[model samples]
Target: MANKIVVPIKQVPETKSVKMDEKTGTVIREGVDSIVNPLDLYAIEAALRLRDRYGGEIVGISMGPKKSVKALKEAVSMGVDSAILLSDRAFAGSDTWATSLILASAIRKIGDFGLVVCGERATDGDTGQVGPGIASFLGIPALTYVSRIQDLSDKLCRAERLIEDGREILETSLPAVLTVIKEAGEPRLPTLRGKKRAKDLDVQIWGNDELGIDPDKIGLKGSPTRVVKIYRPKVARKCTIAEAKDEASVGPAVDRMCGFLADKGVLQ
Candidate 1:
């Protein structure tokens, strides 16, 4: 049997278009369009490349509302063999820790896996904790910020990791997890055949009961973090728009702009 590599993905609202509900402090998804988390695409691509070279199955997993099926289908179009979605009211309001626990349970139910790949972070939270959190829950070695995969065999996997100051090369055995960085590479586009196959692929939907997850460890009660408040930062800078108003006034406008910058300590 070929090794099975699982990739966990998320559907996030387009950052620029996201609107927050001031009363509930939650994202307003009504008008906001959602897309697959960009970083996770790199992870998916990495898994696809490995499958091409080593021969294995790639499975995409996601935890969200039913609408997230779009994200899973998108993964299918990217060549994932199959996909799974974990959805239920029980999963609502889960923090990173709770989310990872749920994902770990689903992975266990899969019964067999050689590797797990994930994006470094989600654009919404930007905490960059879930990937490592999943590895910790599974008790597997996790190589994060991976920019390049040097080797991947049945027994071993080697990759180069990007850090703040420099890069580090790491080698871990199979059954490990990797959280890839954007430096890895751009993801491949879905082909027409892949899209056709995606439409026919039956995506499995699992819930807390299906995975036998504990109710106490799933929803709001299971989450450790709480939002205190949500508000946009105040803009404190004063702006003065200067216009020449006429061709002959251009020189004066330039002089005025230089004076304003100098007064603001932007120029010496």
Candidate 2:
């Protein structure tokens, strides 16, 4: 079988600076700097390295709003042979479980891809659930938290899986799904030639119907979970505004800060 590898990726929020829309209570991704989920970069790097060693096509697939094209472009600039954007308004509020089902459907339709790789989790969700979810839906074995690709062949592939305690070497068959960790490998820098190529090549866009996906099995209607609510972590700013003619007023501000931390159990 030819080595046709697919990497599933996402553009995730800047966890340190996330803001939520007041009305929707969902993350305000607009105007925020989104990065290729770091973990996915590892997966992509793994796929690219494999493709480089053994001749094959590296396909990048992502599902998100139109804005998510930025992430796909970055992958293309890293030498991915093909890319697919799966977007639909009907997929608005899908949680991990629903998202996995949609991706599983899309993967099934990709026809000849031999290996599928994904990040262990998205920085925003941190669910670490989607990779395995896709595996379950597709009825395939999944190896996750992969730190290194030990050895690979068309029929059998081996990897070093990172666990909480240490690591383990695991082997699985060709059609297996892999969820990679950041420790797997560093992602490659985009070359001038690769970037130019990415700019010219059109990324294929797929809708639910194009994937031959049933509405009842995809988007909101087919999703089994929902985002009941989303919100930003409130940051309390401490400003004295103390019209203090002298430095003495700093005492109240200091005491207030100390008390706040004490109440929050951040200080003893």
Candidate 3:
């Protein structure tokens, strides 16, 4: 099996406090509490498992503002061998396509990796496109929604993927990208020793200068998609109370319920 694995992670606003700037079509992260994307923890755990079994180095990478270093440190505390942060003003407002391109560039700089692992999706974006996008940029196979790694070798990887109906087993060449689902396993908490190591770790920070990405093709300027608008969905409900104080009223109450159901097309 390839001895070096790369895991791409994200820092996201706490779900409950997530907000968007309608004008800019970007998440409002200022003053918001952030944490390592929960789903990404599974990816970290999976990479750690692979490294433990195969004996390799696990490198964690993240693209965000300087504050995002927190997320990388969290990954390191969970046993990542080291971590790197991709931060720069030019990287602001990057969509999945641009984000993937930047990450792929970083991976290229850390070349000779055997595999790349990622979370199924990021809560803030709720889009699972980055994993496959990275694979496309790297010209490697992309295995998504993978719940388990059945087997691994220098030239091949067999995994169990979660599908709509059930699970599917497939094998792909090494140096592929895998988007891990929660079913893979529960992530472990950071141990005291790991925490100590992470505290002293000097995470590397790379920017556009290091990646040498074209300024016009690295952030909002490079994104092909845009959020035109965002609004809370209006949920309107009408409550109709049908009282059945006695047995004599039960039939009428039932009829009313059925009528309401029919009116709403719930009963066809």
Candidates in order have lDDT scores of 0.88, 0.82, 0.93
Candidate 2 has what TM-score? 0.82
Span of 10 residues, lowest total lDDT, candidate 2: 237-246
- Please say which candidate is ahead in lDDT: 1 or 2: 1
Q: Compared with the true structure, what per-residue lDDT tens digits does model 2 show for residues 1-268?
A: 3458888888888777677666544566778888889889888899988887777898888888888888898999988888888888776656788788888888888857678889889988788999999899889889988888878777888889988899999899878889998887888999898899888888888876686666676565666765566656797987544343468877886777778788789999
lDDT of 1: 0.88
lDDT by residue (46-83, candidate 3, tens digit) is: 99998888889999999988888889988998999999
What would the per-residue lDDT of candidate 1 be over residues 1-268, giving only the tens digit for each residue? 2369999999999988888777656566665799999999999999998888888899999999888888999999989999999998999888899999999888878857988999999998898898888889889889999999888877889999998999989899878889998888789999899899988888899998898877998787888787779889999988876789899999988998999999989999
Each model's total of backbone clashes: 0, 0, 0
Clash pairs, candidate 3, are none
Give Cα distance to truth, residue 251, candidate 3, Å: 16
